[model samples]
Target: MRTFLDSFFILCLCFTTARSLECTRCTDYSGEGCSQTTSACPANTNTCVFTYSELRIANQVVPLTTKTCGNDNECNQISRMTLAEDTSFLRSSTCCNSDNCTSPTPILPVLDTTPNGFSCPACYLINSTSCQSTGTIACRGDETRCIRMSINGGATFSLAFQGCSSANICSMQQYFNGLNSQLNYGVACCDPSSQGSNTCTV
Candidate 1:
């Protein structure tokens, strides 16, 4: 007869097999030519995710792409924010369910340059958690709300962004908050037209 410890070991192994998944993981800051490698997903992550993001500051544009394991709620979503006429941020994500299943590259949303008759204070900074507004910037497209986003994880990782953004971007507060437990994230939003509106402060 098998010992009790043998049966328990078998059960644990079966549970691990049922929960484990393998997925591709990599990040491309240049947004191109990112080679992929496979890795096992965490027990809590169920889907393989591909994400693309573009950040425009003045005349400079930075693009990033990433593939990793995530949850189902992060799939097939796009988020956008316009801090000024010449500065903005956009991100999109796609997902798959099976092991090593590569999902299609996410496409960025069309840019809208038309002025939306709104404006807000704007600033962007890295390696710091506080920034003073250099000046005001005209909002564009559906960007009607002034917003602020901050992330801090240590001396090497810190970001502060403030400007005008679409209301839909505010909906990502919960998602951003759930991103990492070791990091601090803060998001605030308000109407720029409101009296004494200052949502972008620090």
Candidate 2:
């Protein structure tokens, strides 16, 4: 009886160890490479992910990069949104499956400026959950859908943005939310001509 109990415990320990995965974790805001440290991923995560994002508002551009553990579903995903002629957001991610595997920095997708004959209400604001559209904006490239994305960065910081986006941005909302536990997001999508409040509901 004693031998059987010990064997059962050993088997459970080995199974846990086999299911564990390690990944690199880091963040950078200068577009330069980040200093990475190995971290054991949570039981629900399975891949090492590297992501890069660029936000352009007016004439200023901000770039951010991060490496962390994620799931395989988020691998090689890209999302883009254009709120106005001077404001846009782009993000891309790459993923790998080995412990401490080095992933190349994700490349932002090329900007498509050609008009696609669609228009939508546009707004952007920080530290606010609701925003009133300044005006409608013309949609370009593959931005045939309207999107409203609200990001809660912390107790005191929130962002509201409504604009035109590619369909992938709406489909990948879950993956985006999983990228950072410190942030919460609400993403909705609709056709450009849709009417009513629930029009944006995905």
Candidate 3:
């Protein structure tokens, strides 16, 4: 009885083996090679690695001077990339009101309607449509804050300022200049020349 059962099990195993088919590989539309889905392989059959750098601001100036990498240590004293070919990285000031003690807005206005003095700390709400990247504006005085709104009603932006001295349009113009320089780095599509006070846009 044991021998008969062993022989039966062997026959069943052979039958199942005969019914199974081998998997086939397609050529033109094969999902294995780079031609179909796995495109752009790395050189030397290895993966590619990328490194990105950013700027650090301190004391209203660039902080880091050099960068070095080791097994456990990494360099952080690098600035933003400059336009010069030789200078791969350049340092720039961070957004105002950082730990470095530089104030973002300097002027403070007494009243929203009347421009009394240099208004730096004061906040002004503006419409998203009229306050554009390429528009001209005149300042009422020195210590006031200026804000611009996004075209799509996305976000509100405060002016990047150093300090306000008088209640003149010059203070406002300088604020616009600094704001333009900073925004130009990120938004290339937005032209800063359109926002200048002295310059006229045609």
Q: Which candidate should be chosen as best, given TM-score against the real structure?
A: 2
lDDT of 2 by residue, 1-202 (tens): 2221121111001012234688777766688957666777767778888888877778887777777777787679777789888988777889888988987779987888888777778887777766888677878878878888777766746777788898887875665565545556778888755553312432
Cand. 3 Cα-lDDT: 0.20
**Regions of candidate 2 where Cα sits further than 4 Å from its true position:** 1-19, 153-155, 179-182, 192-202
Residue pairs in candidate 2 whose N, alpha carbon or C atoms collide under 3 angstroms: none
- Which regions of candidate 3 fall more than 4 Å away from where they truly are? 1-124, 127-166, 169-171, 179-202
Identify the leading candidate in terms of lDDT. 2
Candidates, ranked, TM-score:
2, 1, 3
TM-score of each: 0.71, 0.78, 0.14
Candidate 1 lDDT over residue span 36-77, tens digit each: 767777687788878887777787777777777777877897
Tell me the RMSD of model 2 versus the true structure: 12.2
Which is better, 1 or 3, measured by TM-score? 1
- Candidate 1 Cα outliers beyond 4 Å, as residue runs: 1-20, 173-182, 191-202
Q: Write the per-residue lDDT of candidate 3 for residues 44-139, one digit (tens) a residue.
A: 111111112222123222112111111111112111211111211222111111112221211112322233332222111222223223332332
